[model samples]
Target chain A: MYVAVKGGERAIDNAHAFLAEERRGDPAVPDLSVAQIREQMALAVNRVMTEGSLYDPDLAALAIKQARGDLIEAIFLIRAYRTTLPRLGYSTPVDTGKMATTRRISATYKDLPGGQILGPTFDYTHRLIDFALAAEGDAPPAPQASPLGDVPRVTGFLDREGLIEEEPASDATPGDLTREPMELPADRALRLQALTRGDEGFILSLAYSSQRGFGRTHPFVGELRIGEVAVEMDISELGVAIEIGEITVTECETVNQFTGSKTQPPQFTRGYGLVFGQTERKAISMSLVDRALRWKELGEDDTGAPVQDQEFVLMHADNIQATGFLEHIKLPHYVDFQSELELVRRLRAGMTEAAE
Target chain B: MGLLARAPADRLAALYPHISEHAVLRGPETGAVMVRGRQGGTGAPFNLGEMTLTRCSVRLPCGKDGHAYVQGRNKDHARRAAVLDALLQTEAIGEVTARVLAPLAEAESAQRTARASKAAATKVEFFTMVRGED
Candidate 1:
């Protein structure tokens, strides 16, 4: 039972005012612009966009700014704002094969077509604190070289000999979680959607757990690429597909060990993760979780693992819902607690009398 | 239309002839387009996420209608793009392409080349030997 208490309206208003003031910080410092956040703190914006399930960088930057750089709070604001906008229509499925790739690499091979272009990675960088960055100074420009050509997917090589599982193309439309209520025993598409937008930390931990032998799949990174793909929409008025814009995305494909089933022979299976912007961590994590979740599909036993528990993962992955349930205790539970208090006291008195 | 939407509003304004009036057939209102991606990048379509976009539908006085969808909430960009689209359908298509699309495409190509060059520099060198195990 719950009661609506009607006090502290002024207090609430004052608290909000104080919050706004605090958000501004010391008056001496210059204010941070949305553009700066969008450009400088790009990874933050990327995470917000992927988890918030929105594609507009500017909106994500604005949300990040308003939330005082609290990412989950920023994601919450984005989701709240997202629900208000009317959905115009659907875009034609983006073709990532034609992506103007900035970064392309494969762990399965030492070298692949288009070579391993490690565009702006932290892999080789020592984790040393570069104090030069803290004070202020411009870094030198990266050297320019002749552009690479034909960055093909590593999975395609295995596909040539039918060594890897074939995921045949289809024109069928997959489920939309935003518009529809989630149903249990979801297909791969639905599961991918949930994982892609799930909290990064939660997904990361789960991925880490799977690798730690909970529900190991013996995963290998077949390919990881970050690039821009054009967004095309079939406009009815124009009677053609129009390229509205382009957005950067990171895609990770994992080749996992697959034991033979009664219906099929031994072959390498694939786990995929594609997310908006250069969010390789989330993308890679998403791929690992995706493979682990495919236990049933692959004819492997569930092993009673948390990774294999689709319902648990999907239902609790959203930070907004999880936080709402956990944070609601902060609200006044006066009546509920009062009843419990009386019951406890009465029970104690009865026990004392019985002892006498 | 794609090139028009991608072009800057100020650039479009400067290049295209001033259209006195046009019927606002649809909207210069902000909405979202549900972006879909393929399964494993080559299979069944699944909803990726919604992208904020502003769209406009306009018909010129000469009856050449245009529709455009531009990324983000800039109503002016959407409207200008739509106006340019309508103008392109008219006899002035050649002039519009020369003035607007050509210059925009050149600039875009230049930017793409610059980015690709930077990326190309980071490609792995096969000849670089790893340290021998102790």
Candidate 2:
């Protein structure tokens, strides 16, 4: 006869209380405010917002505070909180072509029309940490320059010359991955959506793998731009479009080498990435992976890489799902463990009897 | 609709105090929802993020059911909106519209105009001069 373990309600409550205390650290120290987290720990907040798929900085900060600064936990909180609200309306798709770019650079062209504006970037910065930043010190103001009017996309230049594959304009509504079940062999629109919200590290590894001959497609950084875009909604009652808000987005377009195929001539292919906020690494990785995933549609032979499998990549890309399943091991598995234990004992007894 | 949904709860309550007598058919509970985004205006839908929302349904004394869903986590606003919605379905529509909807609409319009003007103040226009060399 087996007795089930019980009577730990008070202990569980105490454990929770201890966790709260631990989260606070020292009582003597000042408690961190949501605003402080939003302002100072902005990159972490950005990551949470990007992964969480919500652009609200204040709410992201609050989630960070509630989760004790664990970014994944913060994202989880945001995800949980997001599922309850009703979707009021859908905004018009943001036009990245008209984006008021702050940082626009291209490796393919030095004298691009936009004239390389190196708006706040970590590319040139040395990896060495500055000790002076340990103490609060006001930094000098950055130099300002006027941006060129409507900096045309570098991809547009290629498109003009008919050097790249044409992405024909489509007006069909794409399926909502969250609302509907993810079907296999998803369209480009659906795949791009998944990649945008995919786990940054996971996507990065897959993208890196592609570059390392796993699915060798020589990708060039055609254009990477970060800026704010106006979010508009069409009000039927008002008979006009209104700008409800603005959100910062990072958009990347990668040009890849494509050899001539039976159906089409040799031309450069495009891989696209558009993500919430200023996450360049994620955006770049997303584009590379997106390009690799396009091998089937692009008439390239499948190398059987993990990244090439749409179902595998899309299904396991979410960190929230990954973490939830990974962490469920902590839950009680006594019944299963007991069965295993009995099996092992029975086998040992039989072995001893046979030996005797 | 957003403007109506976002109307201040206290103001709505003050406009119609008898809303307390309304029966809650459903919840004035707060919950999370996924927001979806489209590519290039009308392309594929993508998960934008989650947002907090409060919703409620109310049945008026006159047997009309009203439902309301609003952004953010204000339960009272959702409940009050539901009551107003219920009231709008009855003979008291005129009185409610005059007392509630009109003012809210006017206020929201004014607020929008102010915001637009504020944004417009910072708007810049660029022009390229014709150089003699060109």
Candidate 3:
């Protein structure tokens, strides 16, 4: 009675059905709306977009709704969706210098060109829970104001006096990590791409590790800026650039003490972090990790540390990729296991016969 | 979805509309067409540049609680696979299950059986002839 057992298709179907039922626990509970998820769970949306590499809040929100609040699954959805999108055109390097900033601050200098505006931050917020929000109560709307004429950037003032270091611009186009494989000895742009898409918690921990004598490079939050930036693409048909839309971006630049190494002089080194939406904490953490990884580039010794190793950093950075690959182990691997089992059986049999 | 074995490039291009029609398809803008793209053989790990992948997800009817995400090399393939998966739930699971999933399994079994029968039929019994040299 050797009937070849086969029911993966049925199993898959039933499993899916089970998952669907589980996603909607109770009929009485109000179903989550895309708008509600987008507005209320904005940080989750920001994380999805950051990891997904798509700036569509609506899509992210939809993904969130569909995934049943599983952020990584939402990210996976976004990534899959984004891959289908056609590459329209590359925008000219965004001038963060001319950014219409809502929150701008410089820890390096208090008296910079544009006075630091601590517009909005959860940094000072107390950890007390608001029990009133359990009823979904709506608060009165905050007052709005017209745009300021000239909202100068902190970096601009530094560039003027040559106080801050300037990264040289190259005519060569930057490599797209999504399209291409990540190669070793990555340039700044490639590194930044890995960092931006990297898991915030992981990066935060790694940055924290560096602070606690792992690869200690005392880093100060030099300038943390959160604002909306115009996304412009040069349309060949239009014969000029056109603004497609605006996206909120959080950019962090950490300034580390330039203790002169053996080879290079003591110049203020910088770590940069940029992410979609207002993610200052993530951006700051990213910057610290970036600086820690750049130790070798600045002719510093490779201390065999986690943050210093580019391969380790880039490989384990993206939560979507890492988690997906990690979770995939749950999938059927019986065939591969069977091969190993067969080998072990043969070897054990041979050993037994020889011993006998 | 239609069963047409298109060139990989065309299949790759077709993925854009299949996954998301709203997706920007600036194929020319990317110069990606000029770059040689090839996918690894079946069951091989997905590598960068070598292969073009088109993944898709569909919401199966909420029977249980979660959505069934069917990923594949082609968008249409993914959609078809998802549909098949969804159908197998409510439909006669036995026949379709064997037909769809173990399509390769059946083929492999047949191949092994054929090989074994062929080997048996052509069995080379080594018998020494008694008076051959004498």
lDDT of 3: 0.61
Candidate 1 lDDT over A81-186, as tens digits, reads: 9899999899998888888888988889986777888999888899999888897676798899997775887888999988899878887888889978889999
> Candidate 2's residue-wise lDDT over B1-134, tens digit each?
35446666677677766664778988887765444444422235555554455668888777888777665567888888877777777887898889889988898667544533333333333357788994
In what order do the candidates fall by DockQ, top score first? 1, 2, 3
Collision pairs in model 1: none
For model 3 chain A, give the 10-residue run with minimal summed lDDT. Answer: A141-150
Please report the candidate that would top lDDT against the real structure. 1
Error of 1 at A59 (Å): 1.0
Task: Please give the lDDT score at residue B66 for candidate 2.
Answer: 78
Q: Give the runs in model 2 whose Cα sits over 4 Å from its true position.
A: A1-6, A236-239, B1-134
Per-residue CA lDDT of candidate 2, range A1-356, in tens? Answer: 34478889999999999989998999999999998998888778878878887767778899999899888999999888677555656655677777767778888987778566666678878988989999988987444333256678888788899898776655466666777888989887788878887899999999998888888856999998887666555645446665544567888889999997887788998888878788999989988988888888788888998888888899999899999999988778888889999999999999999999
Model 3 residue A288 CA deviation (Å) reads 1.4
Model 1, runs deviating above 4 Å: B8-20, B128-134
Candidate 3 residue B112 Cα shift, in angstroms, is: 71
